[model samples]
Target chain A: MWDYTDKVKELFLHPKNAGDLENPDAVGEVGSIVCGDALKLSLQVDKESGKITDARFKTFGCASAIASSTALTELIKGKTLDEALKVTNNEIAEYLGGLPREKMHCSVMGQEALEAAVAHYRGEKPPEVEEGTIVCQCYGITDTKLKRVIKENDLHTVDDVTNFTKAGGGCGSCIPDIEKILKDLWDGKVAAESAKPGRKLTNIQKIAMIQEVIETEVRPLLEKDGGDVELVDVDRSKVIVSLRGSCTGCLMADVTLKNIEKKLKEHVSEDIIVEIE
Target chain B: MKIVYLDNNATTRVADEVREAMLPFFSDLYGNPSSMHTFGGQVHRKIEVARAQVAALINADPEEIIFTSCGTESDNSAIMGCLNSMPEKRHVITTRVEHPAVLNFCKTIGKRGYRVTLLPVDKLGRLDLDELDKAVTDDTAVVSIMYANNESGVIFPMGDIVNIVKSRGVLLHTDAVQVAGKIPVDVKKQPVDLVSLSGHKMHAAKGVGALYIKRGTRFSPYIIGGHQESGRRGGTENVASIIGFGKSAELAGNHLSAGNSKLIELRDKLEFGLSETCPEARTNGDTENRLPNTLNISFEYVEGEAILLRLNEFNICASSGSACTSGSLEPSHVLRAMGVPYTAIHGSIRFSLSRYTTDDDINKVLDVMPGIIKELRELSPFVK
Candidate 1:
């Protein structure tokens, strides 16, 4: 069992504001059954006094989440609109004593529902997203902005992009696009850096240099053993090279490629993608 | 906040008097009972006294008791020893809901080319005695059934089982680990050949238990070494724990009537409060035939782990479905044998009372439980 605080227990056992409000001015729903928790909150707004006359909630979650909703409802009821707006998720957690760290998201959900209800009362729209062409379709990331953000954040991998912008964190169908975007940003940075007087070849220029080196130096050595080398493609700094002829079905093909990929990556960038097929 | 421990069937806190009895053996009286000296002789005498005390609790001969490590070891020894005594007789009979100690051992022995018959239980956790009678054959070597289920606390009809086995000239072994100290047991009156008891199930310390082997019954030693437990089980004696077990047994015998009534009352109160407060919650097993201190309830829609975690917030300790609580993926074999629905299986909680449980403790649980269950149910995915 998770170590629960005394306050969390207090609120869970004796929840302050549970159930539903009759004929509420605004209703806010957050989460869903699939997410494992949901909350339906209602508020009675006192328009003349610009205050919340009553607040109630029906929450579906573990003890902490339900307690958070209950405490959030209790904290906002009978308070003015401005006072209710100050009720944060942290404040809800504190009111319920304290919540588990993983369950902090539940408290956030409660706060979101409260804010949504208050926004509904004021006839306000949800915060808008500026129009941009979609890039990472998994999380609906926009290409025009996410590319800039990727560059600004110096993202390098699919995971880094996801963490920074929630791009590949969803279905992961757009992971290849996220990877391509990260590669483009990295290549652009390298190109800009190497264009200076003292700097050298960019990643693309470096891959071309290695391909030339493989054709002249590495391929002839492998051809002597009845084998040949072929360059596939380079994404970012990773060079994809293939082994042909006898090397294709040889037992030592792995050993030959290991030797070649190692030498090429050592002389060039370390992020080379060397595969047999 | 004060902690409320309601998971007594898992294990009980050692009683003060039992602890006191064990204290001396840990220091001044520390001697090998098998050693030949006044120091050892005193320890040997205490061992005898403990033997008699344990025997008296079960109404068996002091000579019949052979101390072993724990209930599991006792069970393994009984089942294996019986099989060894009659190597040609391969058939073994047991109930579906027997503790893993017996069930697993029987399974292992079954793999070794023995024919084993598992008797099924009804919804209330009671075995069909008629079925048991038919399952036993002339070649049956042993009939091993548990006195009470560890999870459901449903007491088995040992008297009927014993009579059936005795008429067929088959040996009977009862894993009385759950029932030994919680209720009265008399091996002589029950006409069982073997019975297993664990000290920790009572208020004694862990690592010490005993198996009762009826006099004139054929048996063999599972553990072999230099003479200890009359060469039945071979190991250096666990003196302090043995003394504690004896003391616990004595106390259990004396307080059986009052302790049972007190525990039952508290259990009923908690069960009543839970059923009244939480809709669609019902007790598992037969209410009247269950162990006095145990109440297993299945709360609809909510999972047992979620409920236990919530109850932990209040410093209230309880047990859940045997599978979830024990880190097994499968639900309890006992509950499954009873044909309990899967919808209710995941939410089952076992609240076991002890002699230490008080009315105030029950009230505190009752007061806090409703809100917890209601809140959890609201969040439950299956709640409609």
Candidate 2:
């Protein structure tokens, strides 16, 4: 059985805004009966104020899918179209206290429907059906959607891509394609970093930027867990750090190091590597 | 809340008699049957008695039964054992709707340079005998098919399969885990080369199964260890589970006719009642040839996991072939092989009754199922 949270169970049993809205400004539908889950989202928008007054959905899916649709509608109501568009699939999953990893595609479906609805409101082509090569034949997932989902979720593996987007989950013939896409994505990230405007940084400037990133980005997150990181040295692209407080000798210290390295890579140089002192 | 369980195809409640028979082995009789001393070695006699009881249920000789860990092991052993004995033969044949135990093993073997032919089933989940006949070749090592599908409860024509594979001069194996207890299986009457049976499916405890290798069938042991089962299956026996399996098999053989009648009555009641109450519901298998205790029905528009959750609210337990329930992106391969419409496939629910199921249990399902399906359908966008 799925380890559904109580909030998910409560919402699934008695979902809010479960019916289609009458004469809505925009309607977005995604998935299909063949896919074993589908959702039709309707929004009642106040055009003058550019705000969504109401949101409703009719879904054909499992408990998690229904709960995800309900969460999507509840999260988007009373927000502007732009604000609603910013509601990521992760936020919808977080709203449900997190969905099972395999069922993450349900949240993705919810987000897709919302995007489709907003695009419809703007009288534009739905982002999902945009021109792209079809990669997953079973699910009809396209390469564009796969790339976007991979970037949004920071997905590194084909299995993670399947869980998030239902790509490479069926027949699995597109596994090689998914693997190529992931390789290209991370590889392109490194290439783009090299080609970035600030590829060359003075040693003093690089050290200052690293300290600033740790103080502003990495340290706060560590501080939340009653741990900290102190910069020990910066040799070339390598940033040596010492763990403090609860972080020293912690089992998750390696994971913490990876997080610090990821932060440095994002804010400083892509070649930044964090090592424990 | 009184629990109503209708997922017998998945597993069953260990019978009271089977449990009681096994209790002594866990404590007072905790001795290795291979030990030299009488206190430890005498338990081998009880194990032999168990071997006899399990053989009697299938009408095979006691020496033919080789105990294994579970049905999956029995299946793996039957196929791998056959292939190992006949290394020159590189082909295997099976049905697409088989349980993953056989299907996945075949797929893995296929990657290892073995030619595997997966026969397709019709819309009713029945195989074409002509296709099976054509798939067998001189290089075919073994043709392993299930006696009954776990999801649809559709019985294969094992008698016909035996004749076809036998005439083709190839080994035939049947995974009879689901059919062994619910249906009467007389090995003498329908002579197949190998047959697999699981204990838990027949009200025995889990972790014990038996594979019957007919006399004069050349085979190799899948598990190699201490000389056990007369050098067929090795490793120390799962003592308590084997004892329980023996008791359950003996009890199953005695109660087959009466229990089947009760199961059929309750199953038909649930089927007929659901059809009457729920509109646009369709059954998913060969209705005429299906097992008496199993019903696979699909409700239109509503998804099965939602219905199952609603059933959970009423303390009813059932299972679904819907993709969401199984954590897959597609409905059951059995339903897909049967060509069930997508509109109904997501809503497929499999309710398998056992001898313990009562008319009142059927009534609880009938009483509450319509309201749940109706509510979910109301929430479904597919509903017109």
Choose the strongest candidate by TM-score. Answer: 2
Cα miss at B18, model 1 (Å)?
0.7
What's the count of clashing pairs in each model shown?
2, 0
- TM-scores, each model vs. reference: 0.62, 0.87
Q: Candidate 2: list runs displaced more than 4 Å.
A: A189-277, B257-259
Tens digits of per-residue lDDT, candidate 2, B129-226, equal 99999999999999999999999999998899989999988999999999988889988988998999999999999999999999999999988888
Top lDDT: which candidate number? 2
Error of 1 at A262 (Å): 40
Model 2 chain A poorest ten-residue lDDT run: A190-199
RMSD of each: 14.8, 10.2
lDDT of 2 at A40: 96
Candidate 1 Cα lDDT to native: 0.78
Query: Per-residue CA lDDT of candidate 1, range B1-384, in tens?
Result: 888999989899999999999999988998899999999989999989999999999999999999999999999899889988898898999988888888877765665468889999999988899999999888899999999998899998888888888998889999999998788998867989999999998999999999999998899998778788888889888999999999999999998855577777788989998899788998999877889889999886666766887777778889887333443334677888898886676678898888899898888888887887777775543565
lDDT of 2 at B251: 92
For A1-277, candidate 2 gives per-residue lDDT tens digits of 9999998999999999999887999999999888888999999999799999999999999999999999999999999999999999999999999999989999999999999999999999998789999999989999999999999999988779999988887888898899899979896776475443365889998898889889977897777555799999999998999999657655568878998999888878899888989
Model 1: CAPRI class: incorrect
- Which 10-residue window in model 1 chain B sums to the lowest lDDT? B322-331
